[model samples]
Target: MYTDNCYSKIDNISVEYWRVGIYCRLSKEDEGTGQSESINNQREFLKKYVNDAKWTLFKIYIDDGYSGLNFERPGFQDMINDIESGLVNLIIVKDLSRLGRDYIQTGYYLEKYFPEKRVRFIAVNDCIDTFRESAANDFSPIRSVFNDMYAKDISKKVRTAFNIKRAKGQFIGSHAPFGYLKDPDNKNKIIVDEEAARIVKRIFEMYLGGMGLTTIAYTLNEEGVPNPSRYKKTVLNSSYVGRNKTMYWDATTIKWILTNPTYMGSMAQGKSEKLSYKSKKFINIPRENWQIVEGTHEPIVSKQEFETVQKMIERKNNQDFKCRKTPRLFSGFVYCGDCGSYMTYNAKRNHLYLICSTYKRFSKEFCSRHSIQEKTLISIVIEDMVQMIQKYVDVNGIKDKTVGLSFKDGKKKEIQDDIKRCRDRLEELKAMVKSLYTDKVKGIISEEDFLELNKGFTDEKNGINEKLQKLEKKLAELDRKEDEKREIEDIAKKLLEFKTLDRFILEKLIEKIEIYENAEIKIHYKFLNPDK
Candidate 1:
């Protein structure tokens, strides 16, 4: 019901001709819409009150299944707009709680918005009317506070109930997953939907039969097989379901189905958590922390088939990593000496070759090809590794066809000092940028000045950051050399090793193989001679 503008006194302005609006809201979740007089009863009572006062009935605003905790309700927003536009001079609700359960917004409307607009407010059931003086007005604010607290308490109770259901291996999500339906007898439990389960099986079968994920999705879409979203919306007719613009099988959806343990009769809960009672944001919880209950229901797929499919998926991923256009086992371990860029590994169907990345991009204009056969490079590195061990790691070892690692003219201290200075300068620049932003917000500087000065500082900081990065790379190279030397020394002392080259040995001993024009190669080992 609306307020009694006729009964309230406001600077001798009579309520006889005042325009009145009645608002009623019912959230089916929290408030049972069918219970008591409810919305219909509230509307009828409001119409009668306006008639009794002989006031003009502007309109009746009703928001069904909407939360009063927020003022974003369409009906409520329309009422507020009308009030501001002078279309309605007085507002009324069934009670203060009916208007809203948020104390801050409710109090603001009662104390500030309504008064400023010269509009009278009334809550009939609460017996507080601005038109007529009563002690209820004094308690209205306190009552609204209680309403907010009630909403929070109710929210907590509902969450507790949901958690209890979830812990019992029950499916508490708004909609059951694609291949299953909520059990009719016990809504918390799930029962497989045979029709949807068939589709799920087909998807997995196609994937395990060597079909790509995207290809399987395309085939399903071509066949007009309803995706998870479509099945929920059209077949199941779930009220909470939202249809996607294009209801077709997608790779991401297919992948989720394949990965889900639910199809194997496993129950999972606590995959996500809301920020707090008032916040609507939800963050994903790690899988390790998820509550699981095995053999919760009849599985759509066998665990054995599911595990085999997982292995197939892993093999496919590894193959992709190995044959990615020009993938190489020595990837990240080959570089162009001239341009200082890693060489690209290319498989020419018959032979493997390495080409400078810079040369490939711009031909000889940037840098020479620095190309070399994979076999030739391997032979050169093996020879160098043996020589390195005999000269440095094993000074008194038996003779080997190799050169020794030399360590002279090392500038460890100077490089370390430069790195420390760059870091300190970078920190200072970050602090200055932060202070500049604060000054701009405080209006101590104009926007134009702030933009120009901030850009200058950022550019200077970026330049210093680049120098720091180069220094770090240099330091890492030095550290890698020391580590390689120690490892090789230990190996050589054990078995006079460093003869054959395996993938593991190559990765551990060599940092990168630099190729130059005219088939020249440079072996940059973990323990590279500093003077070289």
Candidate 2:
């Protein structure tokens, strides 16, 4: 009950315009079955069908070793291009599953896209013709769903097999890790590559010998020793293209090599997995979730040596963390009103004072030291806090009619500029650290000198970071001035019980305190003009 004249009657187009394109697909799971689903079988069957239909054969598009779960195949895209260009008006496939197994996409193309594009589609084995009205055409969606289920089943089986192999300590990756090679007798097994293993052992030794990661990388690069990726391509004769442009080692590469447990004779697998059967993206599994089988291969570094290196790295990181400068009472809340720079704390024989950082660090031509006594600043801040609490109690709000009560546009711009300057300085500090490592490696600076200079830089970096955080918070409050009444009232209520200013209370109540050369202070409250 199939009619060949369905498309001709519907579009009023003649058979001379019917240029047929035959599409054949053979998935990896379908290969070596020696069945009718072979690539050649599908191609020949579809070709004969097109010839018998008295249609002009435009071209044969074939996608071999492709998954039916996805439609990113090269040949499929090429056929679509011809269809859009009006070179092929009809498409013939051996079966529906050959076109695609994704049920949603298959349904879209069959029921909507093909009809809108004015292209006729035919599946020879499935007895499907988009232009024809038949029971088989109506049942296409159900058949597509079944095909999708089959694909999902196949994917699950493949993943289960891979996991089984991983549990058995088999190597399943396409290429071995940098320090090993796949066993010649068994591809699932690995053996140490002495050439690369020697380099791996030397990296551990260099770290234990007090050479930093950057220094080790620089020393290896200076010796013209090829990095892991370069060694794989040139020495091991591999076709790996990953990180191919990196001809020299870096601190990141050195760290990964040091932290990885593979060099200690453990076979680590299942470190990552595909997001889903239909997605090409992979998500990394946590370290504890990875399947690790120890003593699976020869270890380049002994377990004891590896454990020692890990502890050393941890201790170094802890030292750096502990050395960061702790926040002082008015550390980030004070600034120089004259130079618009943060004021640095100076304790001169128990008499604490804040001086303009710009004048203290650089030439005095840049700025004057707007010094103010710490005790005077504290008294001014406490008075302002009491005034704020009284205002809130007087009118049940903090809004005042004073001209300077609200944050001006000029103050907002200054905060934005400070953020930009801090970000730029951070970048410069990064470059300086890199240069410091290079200097240490080249003997341009002694170990003692490097440590001394690095400590100073670290302190300055930490202080700038604290100042940036306070500036950003002030800017955010200025932008979101509305809907902050309740929060401001709560803080004012707490200030009523405090007579002296502490670090936490000062930070919560005041945004910034600008000091001038005459010991004058201007307090910018966090909830200035709260009712507005």
Candidate 3:
């Protein structure tokens, strides 16, 4: 303590009056059944110390239920603002951890920020006062490092506990999935909500019953079926805020609900992981890494229905289609046969046609204008499809559009072989790396040799891993093709459904149409070899 800007007291007095800001912080980890580190207790101790020292108590700043890893607390910011404004010259806390648990920031405040502003700091319990001689002042930084480590260790233990709960099939999410509710008796258990579950079941049924995502979404919206987000917001009366205000049914939302395993009585955890204990950012984890506990709750839809819907969604996926804008029949499906380029929509006078992209860009220098009228192409498609319904296999439209054909019967086998080879190579690499480590341990190879060989193996393994990822993606495409192939007979039966071509029906059937210069159109059917 000082009076008149000097350390010595006036008239044999050892204490002086100074404005003090009492700060108290309570983290979630510190919510033990004790008043020792509670906000009120910290305030009481700091206020008593300030009062005993005859200092003026300016304000008490309390940040409750905030982590100490960051200085983003509302109370902490207010205290700093006051300090900056010269409202308080001295700061007092029950302990250093109350100041902060991050050693770097704590060290900055203790060593740089506080001193630079000519503010005296005190930790009452630790007997740390920057005024008089004490060994505690020298030990402050070390104590801060220990506090930081404590916070880190506590974070790890909490995460470990959560992982244990997940392993036990406990529901650890703050909110249950949309169609389910957390059990009133047990927070870890979930039970189906009949009201929301009906909506989930309806979405799945509509998707599997040959309805396109947009049609299903629009139908739900038209019927005033509360979408999942809205259902969560209004039905549950949730206090939690969400990203969307107007929760109309969207194709993406319907698709997510259809694909979610939670509706099928499966507990899905570890889909996303936080960046770190100190950060709120999160990233999606791969499916293989996800922890899924099957039959954990009452299913809203049958497993067979769920699996069928998954296959249907994959077959109807837009990767093989394009935009869903109505009245635009051949947006992404029309191409130029001569130049092997996509066709662009264009208008010349009153006529609408699909023109070669090459000719459209280079003015016939690259390729001739392989133009075909949209009306003509549609008539031919309807006639061919009608004919196919009678017999089942007339693919005359595969002639000109063979350029974009991505699959053949043998192509699937080749992709399967590539996948098998990648898996075998991965297993071989694992064994090789294991043997290299064994060789080092057995003294068969020197440390230098082991390091060099290990590095080489790791580099090769990483390269193989990248190839494996691409190969797996290709395998998924092949699987989708197989699914598409089996549904050809089913598709032929729906020829009448295409009589009035809507956007969804159109996207479900046609793959592409290639136009030639001679007014010929080659139409490709999805998931079918025309020659078959």
Q: For every model shown, what is its TM-score relative to the native structure?
A: 0.55, 0.58, 0.57
Task: Report the poorest 10 consecutive residues by lDDT, candidate 1.
Answer: 398-407
lDDT tens digits, residue span 1-532, model 2: 2244664585566667788899999998777557798988898888788777677998999999999987889999999999889898889998899999999999888887787777889888889988877788989999999999988888898899889988988889888888899999999998999999999999999999998876687678768788888898899887785433576677778887888888898888998999888899999999899999888888999999888998998897786575435346788989988888999876567577888876664435456778787888788788777876785554445544322334554887898999999999989988898899899999999999999988988998999999999999988887666335445556666677667668767766678989887767888876554444
Q: Worst 10-residue stretch by lDDT in candidate 2? A: 396-405
- Tens-place lDDT digits, model 3, residues 1-532: 2224333432354345477899999998898738897888888877888878787889999999998997989999999999899998889999999999999999999888887787888898888876655789889989999999999999998899889888877899988887889999999999989998888888887877787765687677667788767888788988654333456766667777888888888888988988987788999999789888898889999889988888877775653354333256777877888778898776546567777776654344457777777787777878876654554444542222222333565877887788788789889989998998999999999999999998988898898889889978987876775565445444555565556444454576777777888877777766454346
Better of 1 and 3 by TM-score: 3
Question: What lDDT tens digits, residue by residue, belong to model 1 across residues 67-152?
Answer: 77878999999998998899998888878888989899988888888877877788888998865667898889899999999888
TM-score of 3: 0.57
Among residues 3 or more apart in sequence or in different chains, the pairs in candidate 2 whose N, CA or C atoms overlap within 3 Å are none
Clashing pairs in 3: none
Query: Pairing residues by index, what is the TM-score of model 1?
Result: 0.55
Please identify which of the two predictions, 2 or 3, would achieve the higher TM-score against the true structure.
2
**Which portions of model 1 show Cα errors greater than 4 Å?**
1-8, 11-15, 32-37, 131-135, 182-189, 233-246, 307-532
Q: List the residue pairs that clash in candidate 1.
A: 2-92, 7-131, 8-131, 387-402, 387-403, 481-526
